[model samples]
Target: MKAVEYRLPKEFDKSFIVFKEQGLYFPCPWHYHPEYEFVLVNKSSGRRMVGDHIGTFLEGDLVLMGPSLPHVWVNDQKYFEKENTETADAVVVHFLKDFLGENFFNLPESEPLKKILNLSNRGLVILGHTRYQITKIMNAMPRQNGLKRLSSLFEIFDILANSSEYELLASPSYMENTRDMYSDRFSKITEYILRNFHRDITLKEVADQANMATTTFCNFFKEHFRMTFVEYLNAIRIGHVCKLLADRDKTIISVAYECGFNNLANFNRQFKRLKDMTPKEYRKALEAEPMIA
Candidate 1:
């Protein structure tokens, strides 16, 4: 079993730090830290895991996460292949709550900012006009220093605190202190599930991998994932199936089996259950929208 890595910022005297990174892939694993983070993905597409939430993120993705939240952006396999020409790029900002001062948020005028900070504990995905606006600021922060950079950060907070164009990434009931989630048993189980969800996985096999009885494994999975094991596996499959459905060439039956569904009836059933629409309806919605190639 592998452990979720914990990371710390390099020893520095500053109140905050910003990084502009470009690489073949995002190398960070499931990890958490004490500093709040603002990350802007300037290039590449990938799966983003924030707390118990899992979804795909594209270029121009921007998200804010509060202290001690587990998160990572895992690039697709193509990004790591030797012959791939593209690179992944991002701008990340890290700061302590007291970056301004220990009591800055106690000021009467800071109420709005305080509220935004509190909501960020569940993680925030900047959207609509706000995302476009922040992309510029985040890209510029890596070049500025001193008061100029600090002012830019304050401006960012002001924009986010005032806008309604954001969504919480994690659930309100999501356990933030995931020490138990990072335990050796849970880590091994998660690794196995993510790698093999598209195959015929039996409860007994996974339980054996976790060195737990099947019943104990089921309870443990529900406790951490907030869903039944079958539900979690279906969600992972449906997420990938949605991705494949984007290609107009793939038939529904083929896509279903490709994503590991053994039967069309079961595939359509779980697809609608998780996505609230049948595969055909989902494809129709996609067709109606003029998606950019």
Candidate 2:
């Protein structure tokens, strides 16, 4: 399995760091960081894996990740093709809990800011009009320095603290175990599963990959991921199928087979169980969209 990589900003001495990059994939492997992160996807689209949550992400998506959360932005392969004209871009801000000094949150003036950081503990996805407002703040980060940068970060947090237009992505149970020591093991398992999910994977295969007994692997996975091994595999398969469905010319039967289902009946059943809609309905909905945004 490939090792998970995390990019920490260099040049900034403060607990909070902000940086931007162009034409570069973040290359974040299913790794976690001690500091909280706010990532704005200005121009990229791919599968977004945060904790146990998986979804299709696009440009203008803004995500807030809490401390010790595992995540990665796997850029689509098509974007990296030689003939492709567009490149990936992003703005990321990372900060520790004590970035504002030890007593800052306790101060009366910092009440709102404290609330915002607290809300971020569960991880939030800012959407609708709120995303644009935050993007403006991020757009200005590159020009600021010293006290100005710190002040701007505080202002951004204020907006997040007061906004009600965000959604929490991780479950409360997962949030409670943020400090659990099994993250590395979980990362190994997930990385293996993600890499080999397209093939026929069995319990022994995954368990051996984790270097644990089948029983132990099952118990550990359920305890941390909140789902059984089969459940997780099916979820990944369904997510892949959705991506294929977006291509109008693809046939439902072909997509089902390509996604690793042994038979169409099994694929249809699993798709309906996970998505609550048939493949035809799912494809039709995508066609109805005027645009992906």
Candidate 3:
């Protein structure tokens, strides 16, 4: 089935809008819109889906999603149970890419904002102190008016555009799938892979899903993604491994196997190739960094 579901704001009097939502859970379904969105999960834990990427999001999760990038935060099953009393809350800011003016982003001084908007096509998870700062700004946006609101918005963009502590959410290939057919096909491929990547996967099986021969699929994937199928699979596995590593209780070897690596040697090789460090080293780096609330 096609995955792109279009969405629109409640009204259209302004170019920029902020929405505060608090409910039993986040109400949006899997959908996309023309305006870019900055979302802060003020209070809740859930599975966040952005483009082809999937991961758990806890309270304080902050993300910037580019225009037309599909996303949703599905609360955990526990949140939906009748006995559950917790609610989900979020602050969302939506603005068009050219909210300032048609030529705004084209100006020399706007280069950084342009780069950030371009990068957001893949979605971005704002991190560390930047995320905390953004939360403060977002919370204050509704109370401010006129130039103050505009200036704060610019500040938010500036911080996000220049920050190093952010993670790209989706693969470049998935974000670049613009054609209807190609978009649907890639979405299917990604959903399948994310669901089954923990198990062994073969090029032959994925090619069959794409309705192409193995060699044809190989060439097609590499041409569009600039990475071989094996490379892409390894990248996905490594991403999951990174998340797993955050849990101090899980051993590195166990995390490797759980992420679909059959052997520690291959896992370490791929991890170093993609992450530039071994699993243990990555864990050490995480521990070394001061925890941000």
Candidate 4:
């Protein structure tokens, strides 16, 4: 997708911005900015797209993204319903590499921080105990001002710099050229796929969305997603299927059809291809050893 560039609102007295943002759901677009961002998803469940990667996120999702790294958090459809009452909230911090001073982080004392900041170009997901510790600090940032706020930020960075409990999002190829030439063309197609993946989506349909010939679109889809269009769509459908399997109340066959699978045989085949297990086996494992988080 082509990420729209945004200039974050600024305050006269502060070189960075930090606060608690709350709303019915995240209203941000698929966008990027010059400033580095640290976001702690204090409350919400959604799918998060970072660069060319897409995955699910739940409460306590903490990530740090470097400048110009495209990203967005789209809440589940329920949050957007007019009658829904749940709120989405997060602690968002934005700053520039030179926010303090161009040479401040270059000092010998800041080597670790500089190293991690450089790695943030790929986007980092905070995990383990470090995630919880930083969550507390981020939750407290909005109430402080002046030097106190800056101090808390530095503390968070120090922890992140020393920690290995984190995973990098986005592929090396995507990060090498953050702005893909065909990005603008892909945006419309990505939106169409996400919205319609629950149903049968044909090659001609998606090709029309991209305004390209079917053959050309086939090559383009493979290049962009490193998978055939059908493989990509099935991956999306399977991702949602895994989530539904967590709730055993629904029958496996019903869950398969609800997620757009037309036949039980094909659904079972695809499910195993992606998850390395059948839907029933996946559910049985979940029941035996449920995730604590």
TM-score attained by model 3 = 0.62
- Model 3 misplaced regions, further than 4 Å: 10-13, 177-293
Deviating ranges (above 4 Å) for candidate 2: 1-7, 12-15, 177-293
By TM-score, rank the candidates, best first: 3, 4, 1, 2
* Highest TM-score model number: 3
For residue 103, model 1's alpha carbon misses the true position, in angstroms, by 0.6
Q: Give the winner by TM-score: 2 or 3.
A: 3
Q: List the residue pairs that clash in candidate 3.
A: none
Which of the two, 1 or 2, has more TM-score?
1
* TM-score (C-alpha) between model 1 and the true structure: 0.60
| Winning candidate number (lDDT) | 4
Residue lDDT tens for model 3, 216-262: 98998897556898888888888778767878999998999998999
TM-score of each: 0.60, 0.58, 0.62, 0.61
**lDDT for each candidate structure:** 0.78, 0.72, 0.78, 0.79
Model 4 Cα shift for residue 10 (angstroms): 1.4
Higher-ranked by lDDT: 2 or 4? 4
Question: Residue 267 CA error for candidate 1 (Å)?
Answer: 16
Cα distance off (Å), candidate 3, residue 42: 0.5
